[model samples]
Target: MWLYAGRRIVLTIPILLGVTIICFALVQIAPGDPIQNLLSPTATAQDAARLRAAYGLDQPLMVQYFIWLGKVCVGNLGMSISDNVPVAGEVLHAFVNTIVIALISVVLAFVVSMIFGVIAAYRTGSLADRLITAVAVFGISVPPFWLGVILVIFFAVDLSWLPATGMGASGSETFSYFRWADFKFAIMPIIALALPPLGIMTRTTRSSIAEILNQDFIQTLRAKGLSEAQVIVHAVVNIMPQAVAMLGLQLGYLIGGSVLVETVFTWPGTGYLLNKAVLTRDIPLLQGTILVLATAFVLINLVVDLAQSLIDPRLKRS
Candidate 1:
């Protein structure tokens, strides 16, 4: 197990390097000059040149990339052009906000999807199964950003049951999930983020469980006088690897794809930060945010791979 884990970790090095290249390349290819965005309308040509040189934007692409990469290696993500602050600090702050809600959303989706999927699988052609399938389909079909808007309209605007946007009056720094005031702000975004994953995982889980039930091993277990619940426990354990993989993929999706949902809700997260950076053409901020998010997605897959190997040692051989 340790050997397999070591190999996986070693393999991740190249993937991380590739991620950095993609992050840097994407930011560079994006239209508009960060220096132009930074300067005032009346700023002179020399002012533009000086500012560009200062940010090393005047450097050759390869040279700029190396400089940026070198700085990143030492935890310096450079300065945000629009905000005029350290990109690392800004990205870190937004990342924390994003991860907090993302983790909660994924966990909620995982648990609920598992329960719903198992029940639907067991019930098969029954009305309960149909109902659960309908819900899952709805979740899968709906876009999170649109759902977020509807939720905000219904729950926040009409019912006034929850706040529509922002982290809270106190902001992310003092935010606490345990506090209703702050928690209410998260409800819609979490729901928006959770639904698609919940649907996807539900389908995956139901199919996995159903397949396991049809296997000869399941029949053998049943013939051995195992209770239905115990048989289900065995089946669930057998499908855990697939479930973990799906969960990780869903989490990566939520982390990277929440831009729309965050924009709709005006939630203060990396998605929101990315949106702002793009609009302002803040290359440093954009690069830092993408790098962080991409790294997170890669790391999530690594952890998920490790988890699967642990659950099914046969995976290690593969």
Candidate 2:
């Protein structure tokens, strides 16, 4: 197991490097100058040129990239031209905010999906199963941004049950962790972001459980006079490898999806930070944020792979 883990960690280095290189190259290819955006309309051409030179934007693209890469290696992510803040500090703050929202959504999705999936599988062909499947289909089909807007309209505007947007009320020094106020504010955004994954997981679980139910061992269990509940628990345990694998992948997707979800909801998160960087062409902030997110994605996938091997001895042998 240690050997396998070490192998996975070693493999992640190239993946992260590839991501950094590709994102750096693509950002360079994007039109419009970050310096142009930073300069004031009243500034003369010479003034803009001087500013660009100071920021090293006047340098060759490759030179700028290597310079930035070297700085990143030495633990400096540069400063955000748009925000006038250290890139690392801004991204770290956003990272915390994004992870908090993503974690809640993942837990909510996992519990809801597992429960409904198990119930649907256990009650196959029943009205409850059909209804749950239908709901899952609808959830999967709905767009998160649209869903978020609709939720804001109904829950925040029409009903006035929650604040329309923003992380918290203005002029606040601290945050409310478990207040009704905060829950009302955050619940819709979390649900909107989680719905698709929840639906996907539900479907995956139901299919996995159904397959397990048809296995010869399940029949043997039934023939041995085991109750349906006993058979289901055994079948679920047997089918857990796939479920665990899916959970890991879905968790990654949920984290990635926060970018769009945060934007729609006006939530303060890494996704929103990235969006801000792109809009203003803040290269250092964008590059650093992408690196952090990509690193996280690679690590999560590695952990998931290890989990699958642990759950199934066949995987370990392979």
Candidate 3:
């Protein structure tokens, strides 16, 4: 297990390097000059040149990338052009806000989908299975952003059961999930983020579990006089690695893809930060946010691989 883990860790080094290259390249390819947007309309050519040189924008792409890479290695993400602040600090602050709700959404989806999947798989052609399948299909088909809007209208505007947007009265710093006042603000965003993943995972789990149940080992277990529940436990264990992979993927999506949901609800997360950065063409902020999110996605997959290896030692042999 340790040897497999070491190999996986070593493998991530190149992937991380590639991720950095992609992040840097994507930001460079994006249209518009951030410095032009930053400067006043009446600013002279020398002013623009001086500002560009100051930010190292005047340097060659290769030189700029190396400089940025060096700073990143030491935890400096450079300065945000729009905010005039350290990119690391801004990204870190927003990342914390995003991760909190994202974790909650993924865990909620995992537990609920596990139950739904198992039931649907066990029942196969029954009405219960059909109903669950229908719900899962709806989840998969619906756009989270659209759902977020509907939820905001129904719950926040019409019923007034919850606040439509923002983290809470006090913002992310003072917000507590334990407090109803703050928790209510998260419900809609969580629902929006959770639904798509719940659907995908439910389908994956149902198919995997159903396949496991049909295998000869399951029949052997049943022939040995094992109860239905015990047989199900075995099947669930057999499908866990796949379920965990889906869970990790969903979590990564929630962390990085919540821009629309976050925007709808005005949640101060990395997604919202990304949206703002893009609109303003805040190059440093955009680059930093993308790098952080990409790194997060890669790391999530690494953790998922390690978890799969632990659950099914056969994975290590591969």
Best by lDDT: 3
Residue-by-residue lDDT tens digits, candidate 2, 122-219: 89999999999998998899988888889889988899887877767631224455777666667887888889888898998888888888889999
Judging by TM-score against the true structure, name the best candidate: 3
Compared with the true structure, what per-residue lDDT tens digits does model 1 show for residues 53-168? Answer: 88788989999888888999999999888878999999999998898889999999999999999999999999989998999999999988999999999999999999999988
Tens digits of lDDT, candidate 3, 1-318: 899999999999999989989999999998888889978999999999999899899889999999999999899999998989999999999998899899999999999999999999999999989999998999999999999999999999899998999988878888899999889999999999999988998888899999998899999999999999999999999999998999999999999899999999999899999999999999999999999999999999999999999999788888
Better-scoring candidate (lDDT), 2 or 3: 3
Instruction: Rank the candidate models, highest lDDT first.
Output: 3, 1, 2
Q: Global lDDT of each model?
A: 0.92, 0.81, 0.93
Question: What is the TM-score of candidate 3?
Answer: 0.98
Model 2 stretches with alpha carbons more than 4 Å out: 42-45, 60-62, 170-173
lDDT of 3 at 183: 93
